[model samples]
Target: MAGQRRILVIGATGTAGRQVVAQSLKAGAEVRAAARDPGTAGLPDGAEVVRVDLADPDGLRAPLDGVEAVFLLWPFATAEGMPAILDAVAARARRVVYLSSAAVRDHERRIERMIERSGLEWTFLRPHAFAANALRWAGRIRAEAVVREPYGAAAMPPLHERDLAAVAVRALTGDGHDGATYELTGPETLTQAEQATVIGEVIGRPVRWEEISPQAARRRMLDRGWPPEAVDGVLRAQAEMVTEPAAATPTVEEVTGAPARTFRAWVTDHADRFRAP
Candidate 1:
């Protein structure tokens, strides 16, 4: 933490990346926020926002110049241009902290192989369901005091975006985290219904959860303009969760030296969004 290292953050405008940029700046790191359009990135003050399209990383070579560490968040479903991007980053950067998913756990070797071949110091963050997923129900709850979704009994230990950001900052700036893969989650498990209840409590209203068939939910998502594959993926994931035990881990606390935020706390913090006008 002596000299200011230029840290390149992909998806800097996203929920987690925004926090990463802010936390990195707070930690005295020089942040270079990379997005498709720098003008629209709206990053925190003091960040040098740059345009870098992951779909076509050919012209993105300039952004990696003088960059020491990279915060890579794959915004695409497939790893198409990742090799080129990683090659560019590895050519200049000494370390990379990748924002991965819990799905990576079941496919670790594949991802690890790709990262290891990059020849850069790497840290992988495999975060479970994000508490921000509640935002999907925000519209329904605000309008009708009801959240309709499939799998009310599906349990998830949703990790807060802030906690994930803290861990990413540690990995990006601190030592002893290279080659580590951390599974981050909230401190407690809550079903979809329980999460709705928490939101209701925070908003001081009597919100209710209404379960729908998976097919119905799929149709609803498709009608809302979600890609067909994405709709199917969500329904399949939820169906699997209904019968499987929720995945929970303490890597967030272990890495950041603080406990993970709770679901109720997250809802409480965002209560205004769910409140009825």
Candidate 2:
């Protein structure tokens, strides 16, 4: 609705970051995609690609120049390097929208504070269980039509990355969202077992969620190359979620002018991933 300005996407190749880039372009913002390796980012044409490794804070300087807004996606597990990184971004960008977790773990909270004090116009998007997270089950389903994990009864409101990106784009381009902290979730709550059923329905098979011990789940995640602490956190969250299901919210529709997508839609969009190779 106003003059377009360059918006920098920090994790341009990621699930949500890719949508941010694409949606920003649709929203009429000039997009600058930043990644550790711009050569392999594979972002759509018309994006001005640049290299900025968050591990090296000073490296962000060049890529962030002339950026009017930033979609801050933290790909790291810790905030040890974020102070310097935020400094580099704040020096150039007038606006920033952070892709934060609803879990609000310690490191993320610390980074949130820094952004609040950074003097840039900011908004925080805290999204719950990502629907695309079911991609983890894609491999297992493709091979055996079964998903083995703890907390099969644990419920989640899995928000689509596209919905998250739509809200982020609105915050980046439009007005009145400044100082807002949006809690985003999908349109409905579905348990882990139900999610498996939905996947099965989408793929024309009987997908089953087999309950396993927490220790076995932890071991499996560790074997999948997940860091130890993050694995523990995932199991811990799922364990806690058994009694308290994740709640859906209307924030996505309020901001994006469209309701948050359901897990069925996400599974439909990514059904090919579950197809046997």
Window of ten residues with lowest summed lDDT in model 1: 104-113
Candidate 2: tens digits of C-alpha lDDT, residues 163-238: 9999999888888888999999999999999999999999888898899999998887789899999998998899
- Once fitted onto the true fold, the runs of candidate 2 whose alpha carbons sit more than 4 angstroms away are 1-3
lDDT of 1 at 96: 91
Check candidate 2 and list the clashing pairs.
Answer: none
Give the number of the best model, judged by lDDT.
Answer: 2
State each model's CA lDDT, in order: 0.86, 0.90
Tell me the TM-score of model 2. Answer: 0.97
Please give the distance, in angstroms, between residue 216's alpha carbon in candidate 1 and its true position after superposition.
Answer: 0.5
lDDT of model 2 at position 52: 83
Give the residue spans of candidate 1 off by over 4 A: 105-111
